[model samples]
Target: MTFQNIFFNSQAAVVVFFVLSGFVLSPSFFNKSINVRELAGFYVRRFFRIVPLLAVVTALSFFYVKSAFSTWKVPFANSWFDGVLAHDVPLSASILVKCFVGMNSALVPQNWTIACELLVALILPFLVKACTGRLWLAVLTFIIATALSFIAADGGGKSLPVVYAVDFVVGILTFRILQSHDKRYSDVFFYAAVIGLVGARNMLEVLTGQVDLPFNDPLLSLVEAIFAAVIIYGLATKNHMSRLLSVRWLVWLGDISFGIYLVHFLVIVIVARLMTSFLLPYSLPTQTFLMLIPVLAVSLAAAYFAFRFIEIPFNDLGKSLQRRVRTALSRG
Candidate 1:
């Protein structure tokens, strides 16, 4: 795909994720006291939501990319396999171990964000506490995150992870504003978000010489913060749009979005390989459409099973572990 094509399509879903993250994480921001047990449980749930699909995808990529069975007629060619697993760093044994520990390796390219999400989960409570439900503090947090992101970007590193944390912080701010229940204030933020999003692409293009600025542009952070605040406000208020977003199916998708995000890239790679090998007559768009049906079906099915069996069970286990640790510490 052309750079513009990829930028326009891929970034749309990412922007939605930023908005949804704020909407979902808002509840934690308003609580008077942070519950370590509850926080631990939440993180455990998130971990289970992401890790299983990640492991499967990574394993598949490793086997394919490393040419482990090259003598045999594998489903995909070696070049195809390498393309699927391409990353800045190689997928070596050490990297594979890191992948198991939630660090992304070449085996699953999109998993870089999973690492960031895990880090955000760890510090969310502290961030909420530090902001103290103040708008200025929220703004300050965003500024610091933006500065760090820019520094990282200028240093020739990916700063998307740092930039993404601004979304989480904005999520906390959204919760605070929701709890305040000030209609006028909420309206202002909502409008601001809409305006910012509408102009963000253009602004970033002007500032960074790219249609989509990955992390360097400060305006992109502003856009994220506004987008997050708008989603949070919508979730908190009763409105037509909020009702649409809250529809059972969409909410269900939102619930499983973590799994969807983690698994979708692997699905795409597999589908691409299949199409190439089979000489599928379907055009790219048609193939993409056809591919998504099964991908969504299988991914959602997997997510539902994981949510029911692994995610829920592991969450309870984490809670139990946290309780036991806390009790032991108290006794000591």
Candidate 2:
């Protein structure tokens, strides 16, 4: 299939994820006025949710991924974080410190989004305050995110916190929209998903006319974010696709999605290597399809293990603590 023909999300998946984060978080985080303990609990859960697994993944990358893959030369300019989020320096302690603190550019390049996500989390309450019932604020956030997309392409945009903050705020807006209306789906909503899928699939090719896309184009990002929002919103609501999304297997996938996202790249590398080494298919698509199946399975399996072991335990602990805290507060 042509790149345009392929119905994959590519980079926009991250955008969708950020939107989903906002949508999922808005009701819970902003439904009522914020309180200190509530904010504290949010932070506690958010911290445990993101940091611990990230630290483990970073350590693995530093020790295993880096050491095992000689070809994995360090990415550009994540040089040193001695005292700044961005700077220049030697490589010796850079990866360790950068990856540990969730700074962008590391063994797992995808952590770029994680860095952005964490930054958004830091000011999420303020964002919630600004955006709740304020359509203008949400639109402003989207505009800012799009503007940053331009800066991103020019350079240093991806590392900037504002870019992802827009995405998370977009997510919050999605939740508000859902809450605004009943969680019902119209055929128009299905059409929305189709448009989103098409937009996501062919976005770069269509927008850039087969030319390279600038890193951060505000307009392009907004268009893509719209697609992402439609697709995610469709799945979340009771729409034509609701049954498919509601399937137990898919739900399970969603649960372990974090682990899969974190580990899937590594799995892909391993699986692709194994496929090329053994199968050596002639067709690129054939090779991709063959490896993709196993890569997904392996990634899912690894994620499941991690979810059950690392993520769930801590998540459950955080939830339990929050519950107790809530119970105590209610009594008081």
Candidate 3:
């Protein structure tokens, strides 16, 4: 793969995340005995798990945008990074509401993925039933999602939740389909799939060369989702790659990954601005390295604190509330 292809495909990571979400959450919905109360509890747990940290981070992001300059001219600047942090939307009641829902917020752009996750969570139980219970229904659901995605993209709503529901379904299917395969595959097969997934978009662009065929992007996304599912299977089945990933620090980072995603950009902007004096003389690479040291440190530290204090508490509270509701329902 080329340099840009290799390094610029972070969207691949997001695809993997969506598939992994489907696989992880499938177990609960895959339960044939999942009742209404239990499903409600799933929503409750998800809300607590996702929203508290998101809400806090969103608030911080809003205030940062409110107080900070419209454009921060940092040394060794990345256009993408600078552009993401540059915003001057006057904070009003409507803007706050939009930010809360992850609309029109440059500072917290990644929240759109979280919003999609929540949107898909609502229909996931039905999808589980469709996949597990009826092939025709599953196919129909996929078609609808694909059609909606096309309409959404064509109409300029690029990051709408509609675009990702199909990816989540791919994950659910991966979980269901892989349940039968208890056999191990060669590590070569796993690594090859990983490379393909990571570079899928770049390869597609090179091959297509401005050919805007209808449904092309959606089809490519499906291919990438399948690739991600294969990678997930390799890891879940404890392959060599999975073993390498199981190291203690890596696992801890995975635990706090959500917080890291939410707060890293904000941390980067603040840290970059603070270190501008030291960064002025260095080249881009050297400046990036210098910036990475403290950005990595502060982001990890901040994420850890947020995970420990905000995430765990809200998650536990959700569980506690869910238990109380179940108990009260049982008595009634």
Best by TM-score: 3
Q: State in Å the error of residue 317, model 2.
A: 2.4
lDDT of 3 by residue, 142-167 (tens): 67877776666654444566777778
Per-model TM-score, in order, reads 0.75, 0.79, 0.90
Clashing pairs in 1: none
Candidate 1 vs candidate 2: which has greater TM-score? 2
Rank by lDDT, descending?
A: 3, 2, 1
Runs in model 1 lying further than 4 Å from the true structure: 1-9, 15-53, 60-82, 86-90, 133-139, 156-159, 182-199, 206-218, 275-279
lDDT of 3: 0.78
What TM value does model 2 have? 0.79
Ranking by TM-score: 3, 2, 1
Residue 115, candidate 3: Cα error in Å is 1.3
For candidate 2, write residues 1-332 as lDDT tens digits: 44534455455666667777877777666667777667767777777787777777666655544344434332221234111211122246765677776784555657788887887787887677677757887677666656765566555744556655666766777777777775666768677666664565356657667554543444555666676677667767767677767889889988999988888766655554445545553555566677777987888898899898999888888888777776676667
Each prediction's RMSD to truth:
4.7, 5.8, 2.8
lDDT of 2 at 45: 77
